[model samples]
Target: MTVSNNSLDVAVLEWCKLMADRNDKHHWSHVVTDAAAFEGSLLTAIGMTKDEFAGYETAMRRYRDKFIAHLDSDAEMDIPQLEQAERAVAFYHSHVVEQEAEGIDLHGLPATGAQMATYYHAEERSAAIRYDAAMQPVAG
Candidate 1:
């Protein structure tokens, strides 16, 4: 079975939400805590058991580290902080795109007022991009 990038991203977002649950505190506690919960769920989501999922976690950790390094090299901010910020941005963008594209209205979505506001902001910006692109002159 083929898993799309969107699915992976959605899974990551869900995992992040799980980590950020009121009882979990994975965000303020540590990255490993989030990763551990994410790894297990993601592996199972893609079809794998705990033992078989360990390799996937290792690979994901390596990829995340590389991404952090690249972001650090490109920006002045701390790598870990940048990575976390970027992940949140990416997750928010993905959810907004998914919901809007599916003709789903997100007004007053439950459990996340700030997040929904951010989604609306992103959707407005994205809509402007689409309008601008449509208005642009095309070369023959």
Candidate 2:
């Protein structure tokens, strides 16, 4: 059955939100990961058969491309923001935790990292949960 692109888009965004919620408050990776999964689920909900979808080699590649494209396509950020983000992972050498920890009071640092990590990790987990719910045998 063909699905409405608008409806699918809404579903995709909703799943992305769910993913964001799952990821630790600070962990952004999970959001990306879940958004990918959300994309995959949208594909399936419209009926990509197990055999057809299974051919994708664990479905990891499917959403990964979309996620990267999404990052590349963000219109709000200018070169500077991209540069800062690049610096974050590259120059600043900030893992999600370190980025969140920078300049925070010591007492709050540990708690904040813990919270963010939990949030980000949760996003990944939520994806897995939904994947399982989708009844697709996950290869990895």
Best by TM-score: 1
TM-scores for all candidates: the values are 0.28, 0.23
Model 2 is weakest, by summed lDDT over 10 consecutive residues, at 79-88
Per-residue lDDT tens digits of candidate 1, residues 7-122? Answer: 34444444444433324544422333355554454444445566644444444444344443243353333212223333443443443444323334544353253565677679
The alpha-carbon lDDT assigned to residue 31 of candidate 1 equals 32
Kindly give the stretch of ten consecutive residues in candidate 1 with the minimal lDDT sum: 76-85
lDDT of each: 0.45, 0.39
Model 2, range 10-127, lDDT digits (tens) per residue? 4434333332224445334342334455445434453545455334322222233354225555344321112222222221122334433346534544345456556657875886
lDDT for 93 (candidate 1)? 42
Cα deviation of 11, candidate 2, in Å? 18
Clashes of each: 0, 10
Candidate 1 structure, TM-score to reference: 0.28
